[model samples]
Target: MPRVPKIIPISDLRQDASGVIKRVSASREPLFITQRGRAAAVMVSMKEYEQTQHELEILRLLARGERDIEASVGFNLEAVLADADALLAEQQ
Candidate 1:
């Protein structure tokens, strides 16, 4: 079963901003903020945000590699692997 998302009104958030931040951080899930019954923003823990950014960066790198291949741009596999290893190590 899919989990229902946590949603809250802007007014509620404004009333207890600190509590809302703590809830979102502890839950490690996106907290949907609504204004006037419409989606206004999403809040997430800093750790979650950082992880997402890292994953997106990896995807972007892979996509760029694919584009380079399609364009017939050549790279040394060993050198690329070494660079990738260094990048992954840095993340750890």
Candidate 2:
């Protein structure tokens, strides 16, 4: 079962932004901010945000690879792997 995200009113966020931010970081879950009883914005911890961005970047790379394949663009698998390994090593 999926856990429901924490929801708060904009006023509550305005009143205690730090507290709300702490809750998000501790739970590692998104906090949904509502305005006038409607959904407004969402917030997540820096850790979660970074992880999401990394995953998104991987998805973008996969999409680009697919595009390249459809366009008949040639690429060497070994060279790509070597470049990927170098990039991963740099991250480490």
Q: Please give, for residues 10-89, the per-residue lDDT of candidate 2 as tens digits.
A: 99999998998898999999989999999999999999999999999999999998999999996889999999999999
Per-residue lDDT over 1-92 for candidate 1, one digit per residue giving the tens place of the 0 to 100 score: 99999999999999999999999999999999999999999999999999999999999999998999999998889999999999999999
Q: Candidate 2: which stretches are off by over 4 Å? A: 78-92
Candidate 2: C-alpha lDDT:
0.94
Question: Which ten residues in a row are the worst by lDDT in model 2?
Answer: 2-11
- Spell out the clash pairs found in candidate 1: none
Best by lDDT: 1
Residue 49 Cα positional deviation in candidate 2, in Å, after optimal superposition: 0.8
lDDT of 2 at 1: 100
Model 1, residue 76: C-alpha shift (Å): 3.4
TM-score per prediction, in order, is 0.81, 0.79
**How many residue pairs of model 1 clash at the backbone?**
0
Clash pairs (backbone) in predicted model 2: none
